[model samples]
Target chain A: MTSTSSPSRKALSKIACNRLQKELVEWQVSPPAGFKHKVTDNLQRWVVEVVGAPGTLYASETYQLQVDFPEHYPMEAPQVIFLHPAPLHPHIYSNGHICLDILYDSWSPAMTVSSVCISILSMLSSSTVKQRPADNDRYVKNCRNGRSPKETRWWFHDDKV
Target chain B: MAAEEQEVRMEVEAVQAVYGDDCEIIHDFPPHLHVHITPRTADDSSQQFVEAILGILCDAQYPQKPPHVHIVDSKGLDENREKHLITTIENKAKELSSCLMLVALCEEAVELLSDMNHPEGNCPFCLYPLLVEDQSGTFAPFMKLMSCYHCFHSECIIRWWKWLQNEIIDSKQCDSTISTSAGNQREMEQQQQQNCPVCRKLFDAKDIEHILDYAGTNSSQPTDVIVEMDGDERKFLECESENNRRQQFESLLKLQQENSGLIEPRKEIVVVPGMYLPTTVMPTLAAIDAADEQHLDSGSTAPEAVDLNIPSNKATTSKHRDMNTRRKNRNHSSRRQPNVYPNRTQWIKKEAVSSDP
Candidate 1:
């Protein structure tokens, strides 16, 4: 059973729209290294392509990340998850639900999509073993009902990649 | 020589007109001038956010050679921003290579300063743009950490500071078995210094506390006063208090009118001399009773006697005392009702339902 949690359908607030526009302009001017923003008309959802940094275990490999911004973005953390063919890493679940702290409790509004992409890529590059989390099967089963990973009560015990 | 001197005077006057008191003439003959430049908004004579003093030195050859430009001093501008400003001015000078460009150079500096007037980049805590370009007046108020100059939305930083304080308190209470030497040292450091959330530089708690004080006084619904309870609990309490406040205000207004013949015709109220209370006492009496009601509603001790004594010094009418006692009794009875939300969701739903119509 593979279920992806449906994102909230609420429209982006005026502040969120304005901020995202600024971020888009900035990304066009100077995007983070090894990342490309897959441009779309929807400001609320962003699909970005990330290339693993050189010399890391996952180097030369590419992954797609989907970020969904809540109506009260910056006040609330964006929901970020991997697309199909999710990265095989200790912190990343098979269902593309990332266990990264910044994606959950440790997220600061000060982070941009560009900064987030950089962090995700860094997480990928530091992987010594390409494998799903130890409890991936159980977690994926629990999320089979298409639960948005934002609802997960994540325990971030690991600081090291 | 006379022609050159006259030209220099005219150039100085032009620079002075543009810069006003900001332009200082160090030398008239060779035309060495110091002009203070600050970024100004389109209108308004208020002080600009950033300012710089530029020293302009002209050689004896005048128009044949471009003047030497150097930054004298600046405030609220970083080294990089200062470099950008100087580089921009230098480029403008190079573009207009050789003519009497003193006033023009001053104008370019003012333009650049005006463009650079606002602080750049994301607020350190929230990662949002420090200055939202599209929204004209809806920008969230932000403050700089006095030590590091890292800026954050006043609300965001205050929330983080409060969270930190709560964590420290919780850790202290639970420190019995968890007291390792290393842990103790870190705890001691945390106690001795509070660091900036973004830069990790030491910042005085007094800075945030000052803003917290202001927030408490300025806003009726301050986040800190809401207390760190679950969402439902907070919402219920807020809604209940809001309803109570409205009721209290309405009652107070009614009392004010009844006592002072404000709404009723003066002829109908029949203000008999000697039997009537002074007009000034009516509002104060109503205010004291309202305050007393609020104190009781919040479950705080009613300081009615202290308030009543101050105002009663002038007009101590027996009828007013009787009314005060009656209102106090009514407040006491209302205060007995427990402020609990048994079915939180149902209460919220009911509130929503009532508000919808």
Candidate 2:
């Protein structure tokens, strides 16, 4: 979450590459529930398909998450946002930006792609009402230049879904 | 109840006595107790990897039923190990089902702990085995954060720790909200504390002090073999531990030395900085660098001459490779200040004045 407005995108460090490869293998062995990774030659960016849990309001609905890792990854949180046609949830903006703490300020190096997916799924599952954020339009306007969610100085006020 | 209330209270007291302060009585009637159990490390926490507070609950049935045992709190035990501890204790209770087996159950818990006192699984950071030997048939030393028994391969954790330090500094600089409000030194001191990569527990710099060298600081002047060959630095990386590489280098140096007439080590001394200062480079207990100089200059361990043949361990150390290398270097002697100068001067003078064969 080292957001300096510099659009930080660099190749993964050797350590980061090793960690991601290991994570991919681990994800294959035991992927988190309700998430599937679209494997490609690219190790830097991951496109994960998320299905809302069965018992939740967003159940049976599918959404794609575009996760972009910075050079440092885990040390720096990945840029996680939904693809076009993001799910309808209070915390998720219409422009596919999901406002979650873990994706930003609350990120810890301990978290892996699997854990982040689980958190996102839990966020989607816990949504009682399907609606975009109150200021989705304005936020989307600001981010219309294809800004990463990591660039936002996000204030994570809401915890309960 | 088969056993009287007074008898049950007495039994709980006995359990407390046996475990001393480790046993905590939550309630007296049914003997709901919490007992802290550790492996048989003889109170040496460094040797201990797991500890748990077992929550034991008993019903009004007294000795007619067994107590409910679960792990109330634990450190170093992962989810699987925690479940195993609980399951085994629960089974032990079942076996001692109808009897006053409070103390016996606690002992069983201890026995389980003693059996499972080792750190297992891959390092959280590297996703590599914590206790396994590598392709080189040597084990990469692993250690645990003292505060929380979260274990990691020394190099792996050190690598993460270094990365984290850089990230913190980068983020702090980027965070302009507090720009210049807090002095940089104070801010740095506050941020110097790092979280355990596995548990997120705050650990002191001291927690990793022992394993710092594993990142190849090579602080201590090793008497190990310095490889005579050059430019195959990639081979150095392949060696398991620095120890194995040192041995490999020593044997290679020996092969060259025994064929002393065939290969002159004095002419081809390859000084890998912060690496491979084979004290055994000298045939006798003479100044290692001076001996090399002896062949060329007939033993002049002058600081300049010796400096070329013997790159001080400090010169070769890669502080830049380690982000917080400068901080760790604080414990070391001055980087350029050669500690071997005095010894070399005397040794070189003896050989030089005595005149060569």
Candidate 3:
């Protein structure tokens, strides 16, 4: 109904547009100054400034996350990863495969970008004490050896950590 | 809750069950007990069946019944390589008993012929048991075994002959008859040691006689054979089994697909790289509040003990400076802050590096 594309393709495209638009709206709710999204080719990066309490670990930090969409877009999950100056959280592997349930295997078509960002924010806020995963090296090796990120199962139970 | 929210929650629960606290690791069985040998060799051309199975399990089509295990054709394998594949599979079956779901997708033609010729449950080419099942209910008992190059059931082969005699032929439904019949005739000729119509193998008639003798000895009670004359009935049963498998696969795929999308969206929040936040953060705020209440109740640790006009100061100057500062900061930050995207480059880079070998 939307375009010359097949029904499946059109549905997928509409879903992608809706998701991206929802994300943009959420940003609009409290649009941050000195932060914005940039798209170059097929890559989209969200730039952010670290503005919180002084002495907070994240204070004085500037971070960016790269989001890439497959040709299938929403029918397939977008590939989002922390792009520059990667953080070494137990859940955030060195390979950029975030052990976030919502972003990977647990994503729903209905989840807005706002909810995802909120989850990530809370994840950061509550992450008080945790170490890098013990088998971090092995996990990286496995990914390099052609294991899909979605296939690898990770355990991230400690919110306080 | 909305349907999407409910679905998301379900996905979280599923992932938690599979890879969360109290997860049970199912190890694979050992190989010596496997039912069949690999007809194909362990060459580069060999299908990586295990990887393929895992891939299928993770695919969007997963939990549709488990992907049928394929036995690659053995025409390319040497005897030793073929034996190696069979043994490897057998060893895998034994090792992955608890961890994996195993199923045997036997060819009906091979099974029928083997049933007639070999009484023991062993493959003629490599005497491995073709029967197999997994504990997880991943595999069904019966298989849609393709018979010969015909792609029809052996029973169907017989049924077709019966229908042809009855003169109720439906050529449209069974369009594959002509070529299959020709192929069978040629194969029969080859078995007779006549110049094989197709392969020209020139098999010895003595071998054919010996095989027939073996079939005669091993053939089970032919009286138990039951043929459903109605193609509709046959189609119903096939459809039932196939649909059951397809449904399971679809559910699994749906589960995986839903789970994949359930991940938290990427955020530019500061990641505390190479550092563990103090565990005291959770209990510290609560303990501080409790400590303040106790001090007020006990009338100790208050400047009132030093008689520094502490009681009056509570009403006069607010001694909650730190609390006020914290509260003020929280209030300022909690309100819609400017839409600043936290730099996530370091986090993403770390992820990339860690994912690399």
- Root-mean-square deviation of candidate 3: 38.6
TM-score per candidate, chains pooled: 0.48, 0.71, 0.28
- For candidate 1 chain A, the 10 contiguous residues with the lowest summed lDDT are A1-10
User: What's the distance in Å from true for residue B147, model 2?
Assistant: 1.5
- Residues B1-357, model 2: lDDT tens digits: 444788888899899889899888898887799999999987877788889999999999867788788888999888999999888888888887777899898888889899998888888777767876757665666777777888877656655655554444455546745644234434434443676666667876546644443344332321111111123433553457844745565566557658874432231123222221111111332233222322222112122332344444353334224312322232222232354333222111110111112
lDDT of 1 by residue, B1-357 (tens): 788768867988999987788899998868899999877765332224567899999888776677888889775577888899888887888788756788889889888889877666766554566654434444555666555556666656765565454555455556646654455445534643676655457876444544443332221112222222334644754697755965785577567757874543233223221121111212233334443333232221223323332433343355356544554433333332222112111111110011111
Q: Pick the candidate with the highest TM-score.
A: 2
Ranking by TM-score: 2, 1, 3
Docking quality category of candidate 3 according to DockQ thresholds: incorrect
- Ten residues in a row with the worst lDDT in model 2 chain B? B347-356
Individual DockQ of the candidates? Answer: 0.14, 0.25, 0.01
Give the per-residue lDDT of model 1 (tens digit) for A20-71.
Answer: 8878998999999999999889898888988888898888889888898876
Q: Which candidate is the best by DockQ?
A: 2
Index of the highest-lDDT prediction: 2
- Of the true interface contacts, what fraction does each candidate have? 0.09, 0.31, 0.00
Chain A, model 1: TM: 0.96
Residue B275, candidate 1: C-alpha displacement in angstroms: 53
Candidate 2 Cα lDDT to native: 0.66
